[model samples]
Every structure is written in structure tokens, then in C-alpha cells.
Target chain A: MSVDPPVVHGHINGQVFSAAADATLLQVIRAAGLQVPTLCHLDGLTPVGACRLCLVAIEGHPKLEPACVTTVAEGMVVHTHTPELETYRRMAVELFFAEGNHVCAFCVANGSCELQDVAVEVGMDHSRFPYQYPQRHVDASHTQFSLDHHRCILCTRCVRVCDEIEGAHVWDVGYRGSACSIIAGLDQPWGEVAACTSCGKCVDVCPTGALFRKEDGTAEKHPHPERAAQLAEARHEHRWTNP
Target chain B: MATKPEPPAPHGLGDSLVERLHAVQQQHGYLPPEELQRLARAMARPLSEVMGVASFYHLFRLVPPGLHRCVVCRGTACFVRGSERLEASLRQRGVAFETASCVGACGQAPVLVLDGAVRSGDPGELPWL
Candidate 1:
């Protein structure tokens, strides 16, 4: 008595496949076993397409499109890996390092960082741009967490997850241009924020060592990015039954 | 029968972030951390996100301005007209100044805005130094 949803077909790197029209191209390509390097993207949060790492060449489109936000269409052809795209991705990753104080040696998320893994995946051996050693401050005022502006990539994953998923809206950016930074509760010390529930969700969603547990040392930080996806799914699935 | 009313926006966090920042900038000349955080709480957004928006525009100043602002134009025309010398002189005199890409006054090459007035010609004309 119900009609089947329309099936959309697309080609990723010349492999033909059919997918549900509602799913994003990223979802389909991921289902097809293709991996696209990303830093700002989390599974459950609304894809902000901020990092520009998941950009892929779509046929007939002059500019590259973000796979996470770009939906699949009939007869669509998406190329995830190409010389130009690889170069761009490498440059983007390198710029992220050059623009920030991403000292991997002393970072808490050194081993468990997506930025580190992506740099390795993209073959970014050394940065070409001059290092911008801007003097940034670290906020260790929180009882349970610490925020290091130096290690932050400005990916806004913590900001997004905190605002969109946790609904705390506790984090926001202050200033403009290259001097921009993350602030907690009206730029007050994290320990002073009355709004913070000590949820630790922001720390978990951060892609780098910028946000981490106070108890962690260098390379001791462990972030579970999948927790957001799991929580989103559980909330949706249990909403009706919980009542 | 009447239609249902739409839900109110969450935390006043809508598309007015830039406008709100401008309002704050107008009120204080620059966006300080405490004010930015206050706006974030009132708008129901994160302080980091608010800071991000505030810092994107060159017109927005996060730090306090000097008593007098000397903006040296770095446009192509002004570059050829020795705006560099003018800027250097200001620096030598320890006069606090900043540089802008273009001041939209290309006709007045080697132009510099002292205090608030845009003046053109030789750097020697600046007697304040």
C-alpha cells in the first residue's frame, strides 16, 4: 500500500551505483566504501562544509563541491580523488597547520587527532607556508576541561556540536580576521561560565587538542566523534518509546 | 479557524549576528570579550562562534584604538606615490597608525587619513609628526 522512494543513480570514480535520493553524496560514497578526508564534519551534526577538505569534482560543475552537503542527482558523476583535488586538499591541510600553532609534539590529541590522520592521509610531509606563530592564550580555568587556542584549527566542530546537538550554545567566536578565537560564555574564563553544564560534549567533538580533559597529558587525550552520531540516532529511536 | 503561530527563534540566535556585532562595535568602538560574551548569551550562541563572526570583518576592531588613527593607504596608486615613506615616517615618530588595502580615493595617490581627514601629497605636509 506504500510506494517505494525514488532511486537515484550516480558514478563515483567511474563506479556506478544507485542510492536513495534523500541521502547526501557523502553518505552514498561512504556506503560505497570511498573515504574522503574531513576535519569539521561529524556524522550527526548538520554538515557546515566549513573545512573545505571533502571537496570533490562533480562533472559539469565548474567549481568543486563539498560531498558532505552536496546531494546526489540522477547521472551525477563525482570524482573524489584527482591530482588537482589532492593538491587543494593538501594545501588546505597545510594552511590549517601554518595558520595555527598546531604543535603536534606537545598536543593532547596527537595520537587520536583527525587533523594528524588527515595530514598523513594527504601526504602533507611539510608545510610550504611560513608559520604564523601568533601569541595565543590557553584557558585551563575549567575544573574538568581546558581550551588551547594554539592547537585549534577553527573548524568549529565544538561550537557546532555544542550549539546544535548539546543545545548549550556555550561556545562562540570572538574577534575577526586572523585574530579570531573561541570563547566560553561571553569570553569569560571557562570555570566562571554558569551556563556550562560540564557536559564534556564540546571536548569530545573537537578534532584537535584544542579542547581536552584536564586530566590528560600530551597524547593522552581520546575523543569519540562517533558519540554524536550514536546519540543522535538513540535520541531519534527512543523518543517515542521513552514516553 | 486560525493558523498556528510560528515558534519563536531559539536564543535570538538567528541571522543577525553581524548586525548585533556592528551594534556592539558602535557602542564601544571595539568588541571586548565581556561584551561579546554578553551578546552570545543574549543571542543564545557560543562565545567562540560570536568571536568568529566579530573577527571576520576588517572594519571590526577587537582592541582599543589609539588616541589618533593614521591610516596609510596601500593601494597601487598610493604605493607609487610613496605612501611607504609616509607610513615609515609615522612609525619613526612613534605615531600609532594602521594600513588599509584601498581607501576608494585612487585619484589622490599617496593619500593618508590623519585623525579622520584624508589628505594627499608629500609626506612633508604632515606637520603633526
Candidate 2:
């Protein structure tokens, strides 16, 4: 009848992870330094469980859970990585590859990207499925960064930037399911879209080559979680970002 | 007994460079110039060496993108908010490449993933996801 009290501590792979009652599963495991691949779950933004790649096995749970969304409960058991979970994650990456254009060899993100790293991690040697090949768009109207439709995975980092941060609300998603894509200014060319500020808030957040900066170092350095941990601790204590 | 240095190629892009790149990209992407320069510098070779790689590589972007980008907040918070609207916005507008996500403001509601921190027509900066 009532919700189960949040789990304060959980065991992931037999290792214990503890968090505040309010902490989400991602925070708990990430704090414990476990590697869980997530494309849509960002710390600042709200969790929507849009990307299911971070799914993990919860003991006694009926189905795999999204690590980014599930809140922690005491005495909970979580398995971030398992043989079956790996297969599931691999399939997710494969679908990502199949659904969009992810040519690593020719991508600006080539050596430095999460999707590429995940592909290697989940062992995506080849795509068994056919590419969806949706007619995505590329927007270079802005001077500093560009969006290449061929490489987009429809993750939505840019839309959030424009709406939540820029206060522009310039970016939005159109259509449904596989037909979905990132849009600009009521569905117009970004160059012509009045709402667009040319601020590439979305480019830096992209986990792949779909959105990138024209000026930043072409050789991207994927942000390390250890760095995030340090920053998170610092920020939690009000150190760096505040200064 | 080393040989004399060779002259740099046109536009610092070697011959096979562009051709090989086109083969890899196959009319999809372009190679960046700075990357080429870095390659050349790292090898202690002329800019052509790096440019050649840019031209030769299959996945490089030489010119700037001609399309608009939509970075959905891939961060924990925004991911939970349902970014389908923002993604749909960009696609409906008709960008060739579709929507990709990011934590424009992982700590904030929906921060745009940006190369520049703050510019006019640009979104203000937010913490990284």
C-alpha cells in the first residue's frame, strides 16, 4: 500500500554501496566507483530513464533496472555487471549503432567518446542489425560547434542545455519512437531559428560525435569519473564551482 | 645522413589525405585543421604530415558543420524529465543529423552542452554532467 522506505545501503557485485535515503542508485554506485555506462542520466538534470543502457540486475527484482533512475533501499542487492546484463548492454549499444550513424573511424570523437568506449566494453565487434538510417539533420549555423545528423543517437543533451540552462528553450524533440530527433526553434534551421543563441551548451555534453565543438581540441579527452568524484566531493563541500 | 626536408602540400592537406578521408566518411564528415597541425607537430614532420592524416583518415571533419545541433541533457536530472520534446524540436526543424543528448546542465534542469561558456545567443555555463 505504501512505498518501501529507501535503501540506505546496497550490495553491488557483493560489494556494499551506501548513500543517503534521498540518493538515487546512480549516485550510490558512482560514489562507490563502479562503472555503469549511462548516456541520458546526468547529475544536474532530472532522471527520466530514457536511455536504458545503464540497466543492472537487482536481486529478487522482476526485471533489469536502470541504474540512473532507481532509488536505493537498505539491504538492497544490486548487480551492476553480469553476463546477462553485459548482453543487454551490448544489445543497447548495438541498437544505438544500428539506429543512428556511428562511424567511429571517421568521427571527430574517434578515440575519445563514451559510445566508442562502451562499444569496446560491450564487445561490439559488428552490428547484427540493419541501420535505421533516419534522415537526421546537421546544423553548423553556430560558429563554434556543429551537429552532424549522421552521427546523432537522439540522446537530447542539447535540448536540455537550451531549455534548462540557456533559458532559451530553443531545442526540442519531434516525432515519436524511432522517428524522434533533436529540433531547433519551433522546427526550423538553427541558423534561421531565432531562439538559438549559438551557444553550444549541447556539444560538450554529448557522449558521442553527434555534437562537437569546432574550436576545442579535436582529440577529445573523455571526462574520468574519478575526476567527477573529486569534483562532486569538492562541490558537495562547495569548493571549485563556487570559487 | 638524413635527407632534406620536403615542402608542405597545398592547404597543408596532402593528396591521399582528402581522398582517403572521403573514402572513410563517404560524403559524411570532414577533417579538422587543428588536429592535422597537431599530428604534424607531434611527428616532428611538416604540417602536411598531420594534414595528410586529416585528409587520409576516414572519420575527420575538415570544414565546419552546416547543421544545427540539439544537446539533450543526458545528465541524471534532465534524463528523468523526458527530453522527447526538445529532441523532437530539432528534428522537426529539419537538421540532417538527428538529436543527440548531453548533460548541458547535469546539476541544473537542462543545460546546453557548450564549447563556449557564455556568449550572446549562447546559453550560460553550467556544471558538467
Candidate 3:
């Protein structure tokens, strides 16, 4: 006989709720009808907590912890929204803008971009940090897709999806800070990587305009971020057809 | 005197793989594309993963090094003591060099490795000048 996982009681924003012991604070917050801005998080892929947008204040904790990775505990007090958290979240979103060339007007994922949505949620009117304006390039070597390094935020969503779900593992992060980028196999052109299955999973999961179909014009690319979660659920249930 | 401690190995890497990369670097003075592909095939790993590991570290050189290799230490101690002057001098002399985070010799501020010997002194008074 199988036993159910223990439920942990917690207080989110001073409201009491119960969740499975293994569930993360982010899951609990979402289930409580609360919202938290996130950039590097996806439903199906493993949570890397690379983006600091979802950091929340935990009682008795000196430092803020990422909600997506921090598991919920009994008597856990989580402040998803506070004045301090608001300041930090806004700053984090601003940094994302300053770090990359995110010109929403000319972006393929303009209207449908998560980064854009988070910026609005965080009320980021402008960035305080000076723009680096680093010279980045675009790779149109693939017949159907293209990668624009200028718009990439280094979230590693594409890298994780290709490796974890697709089993192709064609993408990997290369180099160090300030010089880091998502590289195809052996840092070669995307079209040259023999390991890639030509599946458009990476394009569908990208949260920004960094990866898009070659034929997509500005604001034309429509990503299906939910496909990853749906596919992961289907795979888990061993079901081949949509239920 | 306290005995020197062994440096910690790179994270998330197998000892044998690190050893193989070191051996290849020792033989070729750098990791060539063909050698990396061969190592990937031999190790039964993806080429991208191997390349990722190789490129992450500062010690591994993907391209060929210059005839005379000079490594200027850019660690906190050395940088505070003006390692940038040494780098500028090397650039002025048209000498090829690479910068390392630290060489474990903080006592000798503004240190540099000429060829293979560690030398520390005034940048202008150095032999490279």
C-alpha cells in the first residue's frame, strides 16, 4: 500500500495554507492565488533559480531565498510581496534590461514575451544601470530558426529543455561571465550539430526573442511555453495521445 | 612552516576526464578541435558537454599559445599592486600573454610567470622590459 506525502502547513502573506512537504514555496504561492514574477522558471524543466526575480522573504532568515527552489516547511512564513522585495524585484528586472539589448518594438516575441510581462509587473519604467552595449551577433545558420545573442538573457531555458526533455543535449553554456553564451555542439553553427533532431522545442520554450523561427517577423513569433509541461505530464502518465 | 595545501579540483568534473584533458594539453600545448572531438568519442560523452567543461576554466587554452608564454596574475593582491602595468608593458612589447585569477603567491604582489618561472618585482625593472 502506498502512503500519501505529508502535508506541510505554512503562512504565505499572513494567510494559512497546506501543501505537500515536497512542494516548493513557489508552487504553494501559485496555489494560494498569489503571483510572483519569474524569468528562468518553466513548469516542466528543473528549477535552476538563475533569475533572482522570485526571491521571497522568509521569517528568521537573514537572506532572501528563491521560492522556486526553496521547499515549503511547517510553520514557514513567506512574504512574497513586501516593500523590500518590491524594491529588489524592480531592481532585478531593471538589470535584465540593462544587461541585454531588449528592444521590445523590434523583437519577434514582443507581445508574447515573459520578460516583457515581468518588467511590467515589476513596474520597471527604466533601468538605473548604464547599458554595456556589448557587440553581440546573430546566428542564422539553421534553416528554420535563428539565435540572436543580443536578446539572450542567459536563462539556460533552451539549454535545459534540449538536454532534459528532447534528449538531444545539443546546447550548452560556454565561456565565463560577460563572455558567456549558449553554444551549439562544439560551439558550432546550429545547423552543423548532427546531434540535434531538428525539433522546434527550443524555440517554443524560449521566454524571449533570442530564439525564434527564421520566417517570424517582429512580434510574429508565438511561443508555446505550456507545451513543455504538457509533454512532461504526458510522458509521466505514459500516454501518447492528448487526453 | 605550514605545508602547502593541494588546490581543489574543478567542480562537476570526473578526475579521469580532468586528467585526460591535462594530458592532451600537455602534449599539444592546447586543446585542438580534432583532439576534443576524439576525446569526446573516446569518453562516450557529447562533444558539446566536453567543450563546455573545457571552455569554462581559464587554464585550458583552446587555441595555440605564443612562442613565449607569459601569465600575469590578476588576483586581488596582484591587481592592487599594479599588475595592469605589467599587462600594459606586455601589450606594448607585442608579447602574447594570458591573465590568471591567482597563482597562490600573494606575498609577492604584482607577480608574473615568464615562460614557466615566477617572477615578482617592479614592472619596469623586470627582464621583459
Candidate 4:
């Protein structure tokens, strides 16, 4: 026999919210329709805390934590927005724009990109960090889609989808730190990977223009409209208690 | 030398599947259809939960994978449409061909790109290495 996972109740901004012990802070906040800014965290994949934008102040804890990865507990108090936390989030967004190539004017996902949307959400009108301007090539190998290295923020979204979600572990985070890039099957160029199924799932979940369909055309294409809804349904039905 | 294995990444990265794909497989190599439940536990999610997620997205592969992947789109526009021989042909070739949709290449029709390259047209086709 198995037992249901313990349920935890907590207050977010002073209102009582019910959550599972395993539910992450981000999950809880969003369930209550409260906003917490995030990047590098999508609905389906495991939390990697790579993007520190969702950082929130937890009562009694010394450091802010990524709401997406940090599970909630009984009596836990989380501060979603504070001046210090906002400053930190703003700084992270500034560095993200400065580090790689994020030219919204020339990008495919101009109006629909997550990185750009998050940048706006966090109020980053100007970037203070010096641009790294790494020389990366565009992998237009697949006729169906385009993988631009310059625009890649290395959030590992594409890599995770092809591996965990797609069941074809064809993608991988090739390097570490600011030098990281998503590689297709052992450094084989995009066209060389015999493993890619071309499902375009990676392209769909991408937060930026790093991965996009080839013929998206000069006209901007809207992102997944039902993505959040679909994710909500799936996670709610994730019933794991029948040993 | 004492680092614990990453403990398989939980299922349903949604669009962020690339981040946890290899990390999950490096711990298991291939994802078993039934393991979605265990994966949910690791991610602190539910099973019926991820299975719906696992089943809905084309990005999430449900079958076991080989060291090399051969995705054969059984779409109507592909050259293999009229003939009932494409699946057999791929099978006769001795490579397990996964049935995928659209692949976003309905125009090319009967095109079968290996890895990301079509069978033999040009291995050097794509420049983003």
C-alpha cells in the first residue's frame, strides 16, 4: 500500500494557500495567480535554477531561492517581491542581454520570445554589463528549423526536451558556464545528427530565438497559445501515490 | 570522485526538455514507458500527471532510443505516402524507425533526414555545428 504525499498549507503575501509538500515555490505562487518572474524554467521540465530570476526571499532563510526548484513546506513564508530581490532580478536580466546575442529587431521570435518578455517584465530598459559578443555560427542544418548559436542563452531548454520529453536523448549541454552550447549528438553539426526526429518540440519551448522553425517567415509567428493551459492540466494529473 | 548521480531528471520539462534529457538518460540511457511514474516522484510531481504530459507533446519521445536515432515520418505528404512499403523498407534497412509527425517538413514530402541530414543528399548541409 502507498500513502498520499503530505499536503502543506502556507501563506503567500498573507493569504492561505494549499500546496503539496513536493510543490515548488514557483508552482504554488502561480497556482494562486500571483506573479513571480522566471527564465530557464518552463512548465514541464525539472527545475535547474540556472536562471536566478525567480529568486524569492524565504522567511528565516539567509538567501533567496529559485521558486521553481524550491519545494514548499508546512508554515513556509515566501516573499515574492521585495526591493532587494527586484534589484537582483534586474541585474540577472541585464547580464543575460549583455552576455550573448539578443537583438530583438532581427530575431524570429521578436514579439513572442520569452527572454525578451521577461526582460520587459523585470524593467531592464538598458543593459549595464559589457557585451561578450561570442562568435557563434547559425546551425541552419535542418531544413525545417534553425538553431542560431549567437542567440542561444544556453538555458538547456532544447537539450532537455529532446532528452527527457522527446525520449530521444539527442541533445546535450556541450559546455559549462558562459561557454556552454547545445550540441546535437556528440558535436555533430545540426544536420549531422541522425538522432533528431525534427518534432520541433524543442523549437516550441524555447524562450528565445535560439531554436525556431525555418519558414517562420518575415512575419512574426505567435508562440504556443495553449502551452500554459496544457502544462497546468498535465501537472495536476501527475498522480504518484499507488505503490 | 564521490558525486551522486544527478538522480534522473523528472519528466515534463515542457519546452525545456533539452536541459534534463541527457541528464535523465545518462542515469538510465533510455526512458521506459512505465518509468514516468518514478520520474514524477523525483521531480516531486505526480505520475498520471507526467504521462499526460509525456503523451501529449511530440517533443517527448515515448519509446526506447538507440545510440543512433532514425525518425521516419509516416506523414501523407512524404514520398512514402502512396506505397505501404516505407515502414517495411525502413525495417528491412535494419534500423528501428520511429513514427513521427510533420517534422515541420511537409513541403519536402517523402524526405527522410538521418540524424538531421537526409539519407545521402549532403552531410555538410547544415552549418550550425
DockQ of 1: 0.34
lDDT of 1 by residue, A123-170 (tens): 999999999998999999999999999999888888777877788777
* CA error at residue B68 for candidate 4, angstroms: 36
Candidate 3: residue A175 Cα off by (Å) = 0.9
Highest TM-score among the candidates is held by which one? 3
In order of lDDT, best first, we have 3, 1, 4, 2
**Would you estimate the TM-scores of all the predictions?**
0.85, 0.57, 0.91, 0.62
Taken over the whole model, the C-alpha lDDT of each candidate is 0.83, 0.61, 0.87, 0.69
Which candidate leads the pack in DockQ?
A: 1
How far in Å is the alpha carbon of A7 misplaced in model 4? 2.3
Question: Poorest 10 consecutive residues of model 3 chain A by lDDT?
Answer: A234-243
Could you give the candidate ranking by DockQ, starting with the highest? 1, 3, 4, 2
Candidate 4 per-residue lDDT, tens place, A1-243, comes to: 967779999788887899877778888999999998876787767567788988888888878888877888788888888999999999999998898888888888898888888888989999988988887888888878888888787777766666656666566665445656776654457776666788877887788888888888542755552353354455567643332
Q: DockQ for each of the predicted structures, in order?
A: 0.34, 0.01, 0.31, 0.02
Q: What is the lDDT of residue A20 in candidate 3?
A: 89
Please provide, for model 3 over B1-129, each residue's C-alpha lDDT reduced to its tens digit, 9 standing for 90 to 100: 111133353233455777788989999999999999999888777788888888998888899988887889999999899988878887888877888899988899899888888889367678647
lDDT of 3 at B3: 15
lDDT of 3 by residue, A1-243 (tens): 978889989799999999988788889999999999999999988888899899999998789988888888788888999999999999998888898888999999999999999999999999999987878899899999999999999989998889778978899999888888889988999999999888999999999999999999999999988878888877787755463
How many steric overlaps are in each model, in order? 21, 104, 0, 38
Off by over 4 Å in 3: A239-243, B1-15, B75-81, B102-109, B120-123, B126-129
Give me the TM-scores for chain A across all models, comma-separated.
Answer: 0.94, 0.84, 0.97, 0.90
User: What CAPRI class is candidate 2?
Assistant: incorrect
